[model samples]
Target chain A: MSTGATGRIEITDLGIEFSRNGRTVEAVRAFTLMTTPGEIVALLGPSGCGKTTVLNAVAGFVAPTAGQVAVDGEAVAAPGADRGVVFQQHSLFPWKTVLGNVEFGLKMRGVGKAARTAQARTYLSLVGLIGFEHAYPGELSGGMQQRVGIARVLVNRPRVMLMDEPFGALDAQTRLTMQELLLSVWREVRTTILFVTHDIDEALFLADRVAVMTARPGQIRDLVAVKLARPRAATVIATPEFMALKARILTQVREESVRALSGRRP
Target chain B: MAPAPDGGWQRPVRRVLSIGFFFVVWHYSTKWDVDLYVRFQNIPTPWEVLEEAAAQLRGAAFYGHILASLERIWLGFAVATVLGIALGLLIGWFRLAEDTLFPPIELLRPIPAVAWVPLSIMLWPTERSSIVFITTLGAFFPIVLNTVHGVEGIDRQLVRAATSLGAGSAAIFREVVIPGALPSIVTGLSVGMGVSWICLISAEMISGQFGVGYFTWVAYGIVKYSQVVVGMLTIGVLGMLSSALIRLVGWRCMPWLPRRVKDGG
Candidate 1:
């Protein structure tokens, strides 16, 4: 399969704020990042640290209050097919069959029935959901539904895939399996991915570079490159290098987590 | 544990027994010379009603009355469904439409369809149209309101997902909004069907020349109490069958709903 060239993402000093109950709350601030085409960049932060907000901005769901986000030098304005987003939960259209959900984007783009169905079937098989094509989202397990969500976006062949804790609601075993599945799929598709997650291991396992974010007024605090060998297995978590990296990132994450819990903004 | 061997037969048996109990009570209560119950003295026994129903069912004129009532219901319900769904979708999806269209509807909704009898009679040139108009009014509100609630209650993320997937407004409405609101819409249709029957019967009784409702009224006017009961039972059975038909269509449309819910569990 010939995978097309995916676009690069550039986030320059991005900031987002929301006004709630007559109070302006800064969700993200001076959050600068860059992702080369096909790079898996994970934004790792404590809960409510606004890391998802950054992904939302990149997805063009939210406008930055400061700075800018661009894909392939094109300014972000509104959500488009070039950028596909997989939400944490309830992403798939429940009313649609698994095949229908996968074909949704192509259908929206006016792709013909025969072409879209063939393409949808390809992605469905890629996600290991071939026999379950007629099943509705409600009938599937959470992991299966999320896989459908992934297939739905991957069929679009987006330049950038924005995932907001896509496996957050899964069990530990399912999460690990999903992470592995994501890695294998990413290797094939090689689309630029900005994955947001609270799990340190998940961030370390899936991303080329894990960008640790601070709490409240979230900003990128550290960018740690994972230099583990290619085709890294789940056993990599037991390796010395992986352990050292996890320990280092844990300390920084713990401090930000404490600050977040105490209602301190920095 | 597995179900009992007789489980399949149990429900039907119980249902027949339940219905038999009602007839038994009616027979004993309205027995001739049973002065113990003065209130039941004037009413016909179940046997007398059954005999009258058999005689009526044999007559060609009885079928005409049934067909007339059915025709009026079909026309009014069809009109209500089209208008209700269109207006509901518009009001539910668009803020401007909601603001402008909803207030008047809400104001008129509280007024019973029966109350519209005088206005309907004057507005339409024929009695049939007037009766249909009243029936339409009865079915309209439930369908419209439920559809509005269904649309409003749709998950925002579904809309966002469709948008991100390159869906325009029309595509989103067609794929996401319609299917998402369907369960509620089906509920509305069912309720609308029931209410339409109520309004249809009332309108027919008041002004209809040939209908089951009119037949019942004529029987009562002539003190033929057994035929009146027969007409009432026919209406009840017809209303039930129509409601079940609506539910059957709902089940077919929403294959995504669980089997239990689809089967009316």
Candidate 2:
């Protein structure tokens, strides 16, 4: 059930390099991926595989040294409201109440106070945080804070939502609950999502297509499409088809992680 | 944090008893004319100081001195607060402002307030203005430095998040930078309040016709030793009250801080 027809993220021959202490370090090389108008794609790989670097390029946080990222036929040169990003943790403004944080985007866009408040309340309720309107970020649990982060981004209604391991910091039980919550939210909002994560189950459970990348100087090694049915539950993970896909992906991830460790030696 | 002293009236009673024990020791020390490596023989007894304080409390002139010192401190502190926070925000958030403004500040920050006394007296037309100038200079550095530290210490990810949320540069500064730096700014204000008093008293003692500092200096000159003790006590009490006022305002502004954090402050 696609709700938006505008979020078509296109990355072409993207490469990113960082210079540190007079040394040139290539983070992502020839890493290219594209998404259809309401697709959820997970960039899955081992830690330091530059999966996050790829996502950052799409979010316009880091400039690509070699190619370009375009959203809906327009080149992305800087961060904009059209693309919203949810960081892993501590992204919410500590000084702001939950309601204020959610309304920040509308406030920045110069929306009048009453309209923004109404819209913010709507999204906060969507994330099941109606009673915590005036609570500060520091007072919430990790999972609750991430929910606020999601609502904050969704309220902006960006063409694409970029999440960098948003649930990675939560406990395992909380992460599972959040994944389910996110799937339900996605079913309604239907904006394109580019999720970055290292967890195999998480990548398979939440994404329509998982783009697996090789370790450092990361490149897409495989693009596996999840043929699993919609409205997936945790029970679906124990099924044979899910198990088979998990086995294949687990092998690839282990190989890449080994290679990544060995390559660190002098 | 020290188990919160078990949360009872015992804490307050113990505090009173602790101060009372100190008074008892001081009274006996002067009464017995204790003279070891340290000398309490010439010191005023606690009884004599209490008598002087009672006498001073009844006089209108004592209230005038208190009012004069408080006015100087308030004026200097208010001006320093405005300038320090404004300049600090600009300096901390903008590279150009930092480069252009910080070098001169760095050069001047090392000069102590007492060192500026003679020059400030010469620079300003009035004794009052010069003393205020010293007080302002004393308070400004801590506030501005702490504010800059606060701004620079903000997480880079927060700015990125704000930008992605459609915030322009001005909006990021207002929404993220200002609020992020607020806890530290409050810390700066509290520190600046303390430094303001120290500078005000030093300036007043050096050259002033009124104020507690001047009253204390004149008491020593006239050999009103008990009055000198009373003035010193007044300065201590007033400084404590001013700090409490700052802590109160700090709590009011940052309601987001948890109660534990509020207590730690």
Candidate 3:
């Protein structure tokens, strides 16, 4: 895979808090991580472990309460084209067609109509959504909507793509197909990605590194390197090495899940 | 036995039957000996009202009254739509605008449009302008408030997504804010149209020299109770047509909304 230059994410002592009903609730605290250019890293944790919060911080959606998040040595402040985000829910504008949604970023940048349409068409085909260009988001199935979301972000050619469980809402069969589709896309356009999910299998299948986080007030508890060979097939999950890694990660995640169930604050 | 599914003719048949039932009740009620019937004894029978309506429809004066009422409503409704959308977008998007403008609007919104008649008459030199002003007031609040609600209710993630795609505030407002709030805006328009008709009739009754409302009032003054019923029926038909037109426009603009919702199911 040809790795594109420009994507490198760094987070140092990142903390995020939400004030609800005049009560301060810390979502993430003292979290720190780094990704090399074109690296695929997954933030794997329990449902409310602030994995999405960390991803949002990188996407510049959430302001860090403390520390800093930077991309390519530049401090993250506001959302920009350099960092594209794919939300868990299908956030495609219902009013816009699939092609229109894909071309939105280019339109924002003032790209010419002909050029942007060509670029949008290219990305839509990349996600295998060529014929459905004129369809509205509401008409598509869950998996198809997420594909449009992916195409929309990819058209921007972002340095770093922050996906917050992009396929979380899909059925198992579709999720598997999407994972494979993502891997293929990543092979062609090697942008750095920070994928967030509560699914252990998804994290292992997609990321070069999986950073497992704790329960509420989440902090990185473990970072396991998936040394599995590139272009790994879906059959890799059945291999002995994959099983061994799964067992190890499962034990660590189960410990945190137990703590969360017991009403313990991390 | 299970009921048969409705056939093609069922809907029209049901409609005719319901309307026929109303006329039958009205016909008998007017002739009743009850104390309630005594007060309504002067009210015309269904056949008398229909005959008066037929005579009015054949005359140019009736058409003139209809045209005048329509002209006033169109002028007032057009002004209300433009001003309401502009002000609503400003109030919904900018915090400073909201804080500054919303309080006064909230205070004035509760005052009925008819209550503005006295002030409207003094504010404008012409009777036509005064009636238009009162009609504009009726349509404005619903459109503005619904638009504000539409803007406020937009999903935050959509805005974030647009911003992350490098959309500036202007682009976001045009591409995202407006389209996202459209469903509610259309709802506002439908409601605004209804209220505008109400205000138009009232204004015409009070101040107009040539309108359906004025015709009804004059007929009552002359004791032409049959002609008054005809005017009332004409207003009802016109009001229904106007609201339906607004809904049709809304449907065309929003193709993404479900068929059921667009049809107002």
Best-matching candidate per TM-score = 2
Model 2 docking tier (incorrect/acceptable/medium/high): high
> In terms of lDDT, which candidate is stronger, 2 or 3?
2
For each candidate, C-alpha RMSD in Å? 2.6, 1.4, 2.5
lDDT of 2 by residue, B41-133 (tens): 778998899999999998899999999999999999999999999999999999999999999999999998878999998999998899889
Question: Lowest-scoring 10 consecutive residues by lDDT in candidate 2 chain B?
Answer: B1-10
Mark the regions of model 2 whose C-alpha exceeds 4 Å error after superposition. Answer: A1-4, B5-10
lDDT for residue A255 in candidate 3, whole number 0-100: 92
Q: Ten-residue segment with the worst summed lDDT in candidate 2 chain A?
A: A1-10
What residue pairs are clashing in model 1? none
Q: Would you give me the overall lDDT of model 1?
A: 0.91
Report the poorest 10 consecutive residues by lDDT, candidate 1 chain A.
A1-10
Off by over 4 Å in 3: A1-4, A263-266, B1-12, B28-40
Q: Considering only chain B, what TM-score does candidate 1 achieve?
A: 0.93
Which scores higher on TM-score, 2 or 3? 2
User: Is candidate 1 or 2 superior in lDDT?
Assistant: 2
> Against the hidden reference, what TM-scores do the models get?
0.96, 0.98, 0.95
Q: Compose the digit string of candidate 3's lDDT tens values, residues A184-243.
A: 999988889999999989999999999999988899999999999989899988889889
Clashing pairs in 2: none
Supply candidate 1's per-residue lDDT for A232: 82
DockQ of each: 0.75, 0.87, 0.80
